[model samples]
Target chain A: MTTPSNKLPARAIIREVGLRDGLQSIATILSTAHKHTWIRAAYAAGQREIEVGSFVPARLLPQLADTAELVAYARTFPDLFVSVLVPNLRGAEDAIAANADLMIVPLSASHAHSLANLRKTPEDVVAEVARIRAARDAAGSRILIEGGVGTAFGCTLQGQVEKREVLRLMQALLDAGADRVSMADTVGYADPAMVRDLFEDALRIAGDRFWCGHFHDTRGLGLANVYAALEVGVTRFDACLAGIGGCPHAPGASGNVATEDLAYMLGSMGIQTGIDVQQLLALRAQAAQWLAGETLHGSLWQAGLPKTFTAAAAVAA
Target chain B: MTTPSNKLPARAIIREVGLRDGLQSIATILSTAHKHTWIRAAYAAGQREIEVGSFVPARLLPQLADTAELVAYARTFPDLFVSVLVPNLRGAEDAIAANADLMIVPLSASHAHSLANLRKTPEDVVAEVARIRAARDAAGSRILIEGGVGTAFGCTLQGQVEKREVLRLMQALLDAGADRVSMADTVGYADPAMVRDLFEDALRIAGDRFWCGHFHDTRGLGLANVYAALEVGVTRFDACLAGIGGCPHAPGASGNVATEDLAYMLGSMGIQTGIDVQQLLALRAQAAQWLAGETLHGSLWQAGLPKTFTAAAAVAA
Candidate 1:
């Protein structure tokens, strides 16, 4: 019942997924000016890591077609760690060419989802990671390679993914030459207990090589699951501002956990996530207007700040 | 981490505050049939505890004027623990006469809030609890008394509430013959760390006499705070369905954590909260139509259940 006197110094990293995850699902396409403004504002708000864009085909996701320009703009911020999602080796090459800090190659753990969405099996995607890694080494690039296992918990197309299979794929990715690996509850099926168990086991096998936890608040367990992951020592998390992404297949899958809400949760727990909640909420307000018809999700923006929060002091600085 | 093999027995109780807290805040007044249906559905959904109504003057809270009739109806359910809010001695009489399982008398720790809203100091309120206790004894009533310390975290009129004062008031209520006491984030200013520290202190003073944790997701930390309190062993919680209440004085203060979302969180964590989340969502659907113009808050309703939920077995049952 006692407060931990020297609460462990929270080194939590909140990766801004607004540009990629937030934009892709929403119908509205922000002009390049608004996109750059959002990136700059997020950086100014003390966000050190941001998922600026995805290297998907422009025709499939027209909202994020300006990603290349956005990635180039993000690189100008010295302190910011810019990352992007790459669907294949081609996307990885573009990322390396752009000198992105990190490139995530997503491989859906569910075979059905992998086939339906990516048109590749999980192993095929793992092989691509190897190819991407070899290409990076040949090109003498220092950009980090992340093998992100999406739908690691369950998939809408094929339900109930075995934990053993998920672990095997995670290890297989590392064996196939991925520099780092992360797990995602792409469909928000993970509970806190499941998160703690899977994450602990993943860390035991991968050690420090296991990098981030991506959760969708589609069922409102996102922050709770994050807390469980934190207990097991996972620090970095991927979150979309205003919780902006939804699964196209899953009828009503809402966005990922809202970035500002996550920041607030972490900051209030004495966790040192380097993002200003107030600024994030302000960013949400501007983004909301730009996304008028689309549904936005978050609690902090509507409730405002608690009186105890000294966020105004942080924002003023 | 290993799913705790023997799941934590269903220890938590979600006191349905939708009727009293939800309806009172919104402009809509549901028909008595809908209210009875809500109560019946909630009980059928395994909700053993509910705050059916607030015993306030009809002029003040017209929406809850049928509280007496509702309580009379709720009494028919043998296992259902129906409770009501009693703002003063007059409200307490009505509550005691109705033979409620429990009666909660709210005492605001903030002096400004107490005077502005209740027109009584916190000490005076504690004296009232003593009087109510005497009245119950005189009337040979078996109803339990709960002194709800509202605005315990902070207040809009009076900002930083001292932990010492809150603890003292909590102790005072117990000394004044209140059977149990609960802490509330009336202004939604409490963070998880604060929640842990305060609940720990309160538990130390009251022992098991400290009963429930009530939190407003005002700044999005309600569930986080609830988790912190759980870490310290507080089990029962107060949540409005769809997160439906707010402070009239505080411009954007929202309700407590959405009941359905909280149920999803605890149930997902493998903690048996005895709430049927899907049924809760169904109730939310009806409640939403009843509250078309008002704002509704929750994440799980929009996003259907996660694909991996085997709890569908229990929820379906």
Candidate 2:
């Protein structure tokens, strides 16, 4: 956790979203039993936080239908911050019952993306969050609520998402009683300069309430954009283990920045994340075996650690 | 070229090194005729600087055997800054005879790498630079002599190259009569933090005399490393057109950052590179077709530009 004083965040957290984001787009369907193994292995690999799956109906997304079960399983780990993606209040209720550490409700900033993907306007999603918050309070749930603003940079359905609009939605979500807000480059339209400019303004608006920076490696700027976000003090990121989550909108587009690659970059910069990169790579290999023929992406798996890096330091317990 | 204020360099240059760095590594034997076409198309695609070939012995590197001829062909373009790599005094003589715009002599900073790769110690290479400079002066050649320090970050054979050692070599090159100097992450053992910290000190020492930043994309930190150098106002970078180069020491390691992706990043950041990314992509396709079995690394060609990006701006005439 030895982040240079005030120059960069002392510690950063990489939340694994492979089960939710990675599986949602790919054709792979790991058994629920395998999902539990992933959770346990990830926790043992020094990953304290993981988005096991999304609380969506089996009919909608068969891949993450067992999210509640996965959340319950992940909860057994002492320090693991178990998280689930809940589309609406019904899913949030399930999350609360599972006693998850956090539930992320996603809202698209682009109206066109919102309508096309979520079948609702941006404001509608915001309003749904306010309702979800009320329900959580009524149920006396201690679970944290994170309002994730998707397509914060731009959208495939709608180009040029206005910065003011993204900021407005972010402020509205925080005012609606959410525990924290995060920004996602859902369609991978972000560049480093764009990330720095937007995240600067985002931190100014949300301050400590800004939870995470989620980036896709669609155009290969994923790690570069993450670096830019780090420049402005972002200490949390959402990534997949093998960078397997492709954007369904942009065919052949890549997925989230690979967790192994992200972890290597963070650890190399002397930023502590508590997750062992070596363990992450092993998990990636295990995940790769479970879902054969899937297009897994990442650079470190091929190149391994840099010669200057001490393998022991990145080795997970 | 509209450069930003002193905070960010308004104009940036993507010096094409695909021929020298890219072709030298791959097994593809592009004919002298194909090399001419590449140089012409690259120039027509708004590339103002190009490293045509290396002035090495024909038996050692048959691919770049036609270095002098390629330099002559590239020099036909009005605005093109034709350059070549000179391995020793003999190579320097060939570069001077070809009337190149610039000649780069590479020196490996890691002692083991220096002896293995170049058959010379760091000091030996520095002394050679002085001899090469004397020859260039005696030959009355205006061709700029650039002493390129490779493995400036770390090396595959010898790890943990000290920062002080890299700086000393760079200073020695300048004192030995080299016209300008550049630093290269030859093994891709660099992170953005390392790039920023080292490049900041390097810039402080060399100022604008620092000719270029050359990075390998081996560990996927190439563009991120480029961004870090850009933060310190580095305006020149060396890149392979399709990322066709791979380090020989590290098996499966990637080459210099791809020209097309680097161009896209710079253009999107509002840093002018005078490169049309679409045109670069077309050239990459042409190059790819020629080198069928080779693995070309880059992201933009696969995902394409985001809908928000104006592709027309990236299309060269």
Candidate 3:
């Protein structure tokens, strides 16, 4: 048997997506001021990559209306990788104008969810990526474009998404001028075995062009699925602090894997994520207050860290 | 990268331990009749293995006082593998007399936990396993003996259990006449990476003699750790239905990984678990009714099965 010990990546990036993915789905409209504080606190806690907010029309998603402001503020810190989600060229243009580090254009592999979420077919979204790339170049912006395949696993609406279609779309997105691409278990439908099977093949196809993995802990296998990707060498992950996001369609279903739990899991596994879990827990407490009534998820916050966690001490030593 | 797809076991067994582990940690004293219903329902749900209860003194653990009765009742189901926890020789004698399918003698890897939980050192537990083996032989009982190493990853009271010590105790348990041996993440401290590292080594030493894996979902990586063990081909697992048990010390810490969720994860990955998830969900509802006001864990109950889940239909087909 091949031991994963030797093959696992040394360091992984846990990109905080709570401000965007976490807030957008929940009912709470966190004040822009609270968003700023959350960002600053997360950065202070050693987070380098954060998807600040989505660059959507305020009328459509008022929760993330302050994306441009968040991105501009997050840029004050040197070496911070600020990301924003852009549905079409308008949002992508806003991201580029704001000098955001990266813009993720999510294309759902499930045609039904693609049309419902993006108002475009998967191929149509791919075409939009080409347009967004051209627009970025014309604007002389160095903003990276990532084509993230949402519902890469089965979908709540479409049920089973064919792997062949998912892979074919990934290649198309790359051909359409996306600088990077990633897979998302958008509704938390992925299991580790499925993750290993699909991601191993995706890695062979994309190599370094594969940006990260995004998993929703909806079915409670988010960490397990992430472990499968790690086994195949995908290091960067997208998560939300306190696991704040939940599926609007499926009530009680969780959103992204909780950042604190993911960080703890990765740290204990000896993978450097550069995020201090205690500080993340502090941020989680702040978030819980800001979005008081919304049901929050994440196990680490409840249990705290194990006594064997010496990564914090070792860093000082 | 060696893809984990081909390496994963095609089937797995989830041993329901809610009656033993789940009940012991909670304040709720489910009626013996209710436990019998749970056992019958769990058997109907496709769980072949069940840990009926512990053989410790009734005063110490009143919740499991009806263990022998439950074991005898569970044995009525043909093909059901009834197991019980035996803390010492007297408990083993009761198990042998009751004709239990198996009796697990737990040894804590952490010295502090060993003393606190079992009131014996790791070596003393090993000796007891030898005595239990001899007693079973002399009684001409066909019941199997399994030595389980708890806190194999780390302990709450004492942290950073040495891998060398864990392996040493497992070897000692085997040498002391255990028919089989298993490892447990007793405090939910194990990450999937640690599981793969340790379990791969353990599988090398024990092969098929490694009986089962028991994981707590306290920090939400239980399923992930299970996935890691599956990669190493450890099939049998110990879980509590609805995650009934919480660490008594930890106010809200979860108990064993919920059996339903684990089965759903395995079934989703095309692993044949022989259990029907719908049947398990029905059992979960009954459990929720039986233990009202108690915190129940497991994601599937909230969201129900994904529409893509075809486990039931496949069996029908």
Candidate 4:
């Protein structure tokens, strides 16, 4: 039997996405001042990478209308790599104007979902990536462009998305000039075996350009899927504080893997995440209070860190 | 890097412990009729092994006082391997009287937890297993004895449990006449790496005699820990329906990994669990109703099965 002990990487990155992916789905619109404080707390707690907000039109996602402001505030701290999600070239231009460190262009691999969610086909999104890449080069923007393939595992609308199609789109995005690529279990349809299989191939195709894994805890396999990705050597992950995101179609479903829970899992496994779990938990408590009426999900808040956990074992974030 | 692709077993056993471990910890006392129906549903849904209940004093766990009756009822179904938790020789005698297929004697590896929870040291419990084996032999019963090592990961009262001590006690239990042995993360302190490390050692020590893995979702690593155990070639696991159990010290902590979620994970991976997930969901809904007012946990019930799931791929129970 192959042991996964040697397969796991010593260090991993968790890009906080609560300010973007999380806030857009929920009803409660957090104020910019409150978001600034949240970002400050997150930065203080040892988070180095954060998806500050999305660059969608304010009328579309007013919750993240302050994406430029958040990116600016987050950039005040050195080494805090900031990212913003953009749907089309227009949103990409807004991100470029904001001088964001990176911009993620979401392309749904599922044909139906792509048209429904983004009002375009997968190929259309790929074409837009080429345009966005040209625009970035013309503007001399140093910001990285990431093609995030949503519903890469499976989709609620499309049911089953073929892995080949997902891979093809990823390759197309790379060919269209995306700086990096990643896969997301948009509706939590991914199981560990699927994650391992798809990601193994993804690693072979994209290699170091495979930026991150985004999983929704909608069906409770989020962390398990993360562990699977880790075994396959995909180190970077996207997490939301308090597990704040969810599918609007599936009520009572959870969002991304909870930041604190994921942090604890990595720390316990001796994987250097550089995020202080206690501080992250403190931030989770505050976020929970901020989004009180909205149902929050996670396990570590109630059962704090185990007594066996030693802060000395962890490296400074 | 060694790939975990081939390490996972194609089929695994999930021993339903909700009726025993789950019901005992909660305040609700389910009627014997309800439990009988629950067993019937579980049997129909494809569960072959079940820990009927504990053979403890009625006043202590009036919730499980109908254990003998449950065992008897469960035995009526041919091929249903019914097991019971026995604390001492007296409980073993009762289990023998009930004609149980197996009797598990729990031995906490943590000294403080052993004393506090069972009022016996680990050695004392090992000695009792020997006595229980002797009594079974004297009674001319063919019941299999399993020694379940709880807090094998770490403990709440005592900080860290040494791996050497845990393995030593496991060998001790076998030396004392246990037919099988298993380990449990009693307080949910284990991560996948720790699970893989310890379980690999356990498989080497016990070989085919290694019984099962029991994990609590207290900190949400239960399923991930299960995946790790699977990678180490441990096939059997303990789970509760709706995740009905918890650490009493932790107010809002979840109990065991939900049976349906575990089944889904195994099934999605091309593992043949024999149980129909749809039927299991039906049983979960009914059990949730029977144990109303209790905080239930699990993800599949809220979000129905992924469209990619195919029943033809599964073996019949």
The most accurate candidate by lDDT is: 4
User: What local lDDT does model 3 show for residue A10?
Assistant: 76
Q: Of the pair 1 and 4, which is ahead by DockQ? A: 4
Writing each residue's lDDT as its tens digit, candidate 2 over B113-184 gives 888889899999999999999998998989999999999999888888999999999999999998899999
Clashing pairs in 1: none
Q: Rank all candidate structures by their DockQ, best first, as comma-separated numbers.
A: 4, 3, 1, 2
- Candidates 2 and 3 compared: the better one by DockQ is 3
Candidate 3, residue A54: the lDDT equals 91
- Candidate 4 lands at a TM-score of 0.98
Q: Write the per-residue lDDT of candidate 1 for residues A131-229, one digit (tens) a residue.
A: 999999999999999999988888888988889999999998999888889999888888776887898899899988999999888777787778767
Superior candidate under TM-score, 1 versus 4: 4
- Itemize residue pairs with steric clashes in candidate 3: none
Model 4 docking category: medium
In candidate 2, which residue ranges exceed 4 Å CA deviation? A1-6, A250-252, A311-317, B1-6, B250-252, B311-317
| Rank ordering of all candidates by lDDT, starting from the highest | 4, 3, 2, 1
Candidate 1 C-alpha error for residue A267, in Å: 2.4
Question: lDDT of all predictions, in order shown?
Answer: 0.83, 0.86, 0.88, 0.90
lDDT of 3 by residue, B137-227 (tens): 9999999999999989998888889999999999999999999999988889998878888988898999889989999998998998998
TM-score for each candidate, following the candidate numbering? 0.94, 0.96, 0.97, 0.98
